[model samples]
Target: MDIRFLVTFMEVAQTRHFGKAAENLYLTQSAVSARIKQLEEYFNAALFVRNRNSLQLTAAGEKLLPFASSLADTLEQARATMNEESIQYLSIASTSNAWDMYLKHKLDEVKGHLDHVSIRAEICSHEQLSRMVHEHSIDLALTTLPFKSDDVEILELSDSMLSLYCSVGIIEEALEHFNISIDWGQKTNEALEKIYPEIKKASMRTGSLQVALNYLSTHNSAIILPAQIAKELVNAGKLHEVDSLSPLTVKCYLIYLKQSKDARLKKFIEVFKGMIENQQGR
Candidate 1:
């Protein structure tokens, strides 16, 4: 049977009025009636029993509602797969670690691999990251902890080693440098407290690692930063590592839709892996 017939049947069953269904489907009422009549004739059974005041689905129509709904869903999925649109859209949310180290170095790689997409990045907490993914507001994320979502696919990018760092000038008078939570959240604050139980006083509560870096640069304060970020700064003679805690490694992951089949996304993953491997070798 024609798909139009099933569509008309479903719409009529839902609205229970030929005129309303026709208006919804952008068809003439006569056209809608004809399609339903054709469907009934094809099935050799009545699909709807219409009276002067009301329309009721016949047994056949009642039985076919679920199947019709399934067909519509399948068609929607097929349309998404077969559309001729360019894959130029991607939304990403990440933790502070990603912004500090990997993103700047991988800009050229991202442009080269994902030529079609214009990247937009948001730095958010782990909980905000999870909510964005769950609500389908964000397409992907780079974070220390992978989101606990069955609908998301996570790929481990690299293990970030944490190290205390400070401005070059402050390295000499290290007593002025101290580490605090990247933000005011209890989780980050507690983590910092546990690491340094004796140092009850924090110089400041910065909003993000990026902000902390800026503060460290200007105020000559110290903070724990990812080893990759610290090493890059030290190499450029911008900052130096402080000696409070040794390097502590935490895994970073890239997360995306479980069913994402975009070629650009695939190419980006491959190029990113190569960049990470090259970094490791260096």
Candidate 2:
């Protein structure tokens, strides 16, 4: 039961590509294959369904993923605990879109409240964020997707509104040509469809809010973005809201382990909540 094998397994599961996983782990592709084979032999199950130009996790692999992630997280935490300098380290995980929309600025404000703690924030997918929290790899997570885990405590943060926006001089043709679609979530998608039923296609579709912003800045593009951001850009005369349409709202949630004993983690959560409250009050 080598921990390295579990690490390898998790990497392969994430990438679903032996060469990609090996490159990330700095191992040869053959070495990655060997580790996966050994892990499969140990479990007496095939972890992956390999096909031409495709790879997917088998049922056993799906079952092992969470446990392997948890085990790897535990090992990492133990190592960090053994290192005296890492005692004050605090890790937070969130999607890049979430970070751009609110968490980035809020984190800056919170950092002032945490005098001695070292912060490590990562941008990852919602699924990855949940896995990290469950595995204890991250102390806290700010996400739109809530996790259904007894070991985790979820707090409703706030509703983020998304409104359609475009540059002032863009015509309908240009707007359609440079339209950017952002994946807020399933609920937002449904709302968007109801609001803009005729917009069957867009020039670009992305999950990254930052990318959407960049495209809007460089092109005469129209996009649905966080209301706060849209307002700021509008004030700057860079963007204007599509007043003909209504805004869509999405709820954001903060998650942390219920069993966490770290004082810094608790304090950061308090600071974050207070900041949100103060913002809403204004």
Candidate 3:
């Protein structure tokens, strides 16, 4: 069976709308419909219940979902392993915030331990990181979100606390006009919303901590930042923490395939373990 059909089926199952799945896969709606029909015929079962306003998976589709995901992942992993001799780089995927705040430095340290391994870091959203890891597109992932997969191993790195921070003299003015928000994770977002329900709009909203730092350096802005970073800036007299608001905590995790045994990946995991140990010691 063509793997593309399984891919199309999984996409439609995820999006639940053939049109939306077609858009995401860059295929025409007719093509997507044809692929679904092909897969249904091959399996001798109707995969989807077509409703006028919504689409839903039939019992067969539901049963096939997990198998499809596993097969796609297995095929991708086999391809990557087969091409390993030709491609000599370890790919690391991270959220922009994690890349900026921590992983970049740790990866640099990991590079020093390796002789000739090249490391490529890609910044992506939290949602995409798990899929990339499952597909073997990335060797490792650093994220604040707790990602669970039977095919992957997850290590708890540390808990980072986020606190409200601003420049020296305009805490009040910054609070009113220059409040910024960062996407820490779902839990932190919900906690922040509960704490400041009236503050609907921010002067700026972003996922990059580096961007928020740059904006804060030149402007009288206030934002929530990792306590470690905010403390470093405060020690340098560049930013100050708002003493009134409590801090929100987020847990960080390092993720990789359970079956990964690449030399570069093992070396990086050692470095990450040491880094986590050092952080815990402090």
Candidate 4:
């Protein structure tokens, strides 16, 4: 049996909701369903009795839980041991949007600050970053949403402001026709929903404003961008800010475990946090 199938089972069993399990495990619902089906087939028994309001473990599932728990614990310890061997290199990661907005500027500079700094930087999703932090697989993560946890320190930084912007030649009367939609987090989304239902009607949706920035150069389009970045483009005669509407404040957070069993990782996270605080004038 694949270990991942067991892990998926455990997450589903704990959450009792397939959609929640899929989100927590960074998997699609279909994938989680497939794994559960495979696990049930392996044991030749129904593992979960699903109903409208709840999911209960069957007799076979109850029997498998203890063994699964033991194996998963051992597997985690083994994985931790493997991670220790790579302690010479600390891993830091963030969602692609967060990295592009905040951390990308300091990537090369921070790598040289500490010894044993074989820093591994990756751009992944928010759920992936959260899992890495909980598993002690990565030293730090930056995300658009605050990951609240008693075991982690979340530093909220309000260094970004998002506002509507338009290409230099875009016609004001056609604002709805040129929408470049991007998910700018919950608060921004709510504010946008009130005024820009056209965002939903937009044919172009992207995660990065860089795509829209490139497109806006030749094509007339409207996009939301960090106020500072939009200012730079406006000064360069590429885009203009739409001042008729209010701007949204967008915040990003830096996340790291409050404590780490790995001594090297602990020290590095401390240094990185201090660097971030200093940059924000905190």
* Over 4 Å off, model 4: 1-87, 148-150, 171-174, 214-218, 244-247, 259-261
Better of 3 and 4 by TM-score: 4
TM-score-better candidate, 2 vs 4? 2
Write one digit per residue (lDDT tens) for candidate 2, span 1-282: 878789989999999899898777755576688889989999999999999998999999999999999999999988777565644777888888667766776777778878777889888888888766754567889887788776678987777676677787774544455478878777778778777754448777887878878887777877777776677788998887774444457667889978667776788789777877887899
Native-referenced Cα lDDT, model 2: 0.78
Clash statistics: count for each candidate:
0, 0, 0, 0
Off by over 4 Å in 3: 1-88, 172-174, 244-247, 261-264
Cand. 3 Cα-lDDT: 0.77
Model 3 / residue 117 / CA error / Å: 2.5
By summed lDDT, the worst window of 10 consecutive residues in model 2 runs over: 170-179
Pairs that clash in candidate 3: none
Clashing pairs in 2: none
Ranking by TM-score: 2, 4, 3, 1
* lDDT (C-alpha, whole model) for all candidates: 0.71, 0.78, 0.77, 0.75
- Per-model TM-score, in order, reads 0.58, 0.66, 0.62, 0.63
RMSD of each: 12.4, 10.5, 9.7, 7.4
Candidate 2 has what TM-score?
0.66
lDDT of 4 by residue, 190-258 (tens): 788778777777777776667766666767787777776677788988777775444466667878866
lDDT of 3 by residue, 1-282 (tens): 878789999999999999898777755576689889989999999999999998999999999999999999999998798577554567788887777666765676767766566778888988899766754557889887768566677888766676777788786666675467777767778888777653358777777788878877777776777776687789998887784345567666789877665775787788778878877788
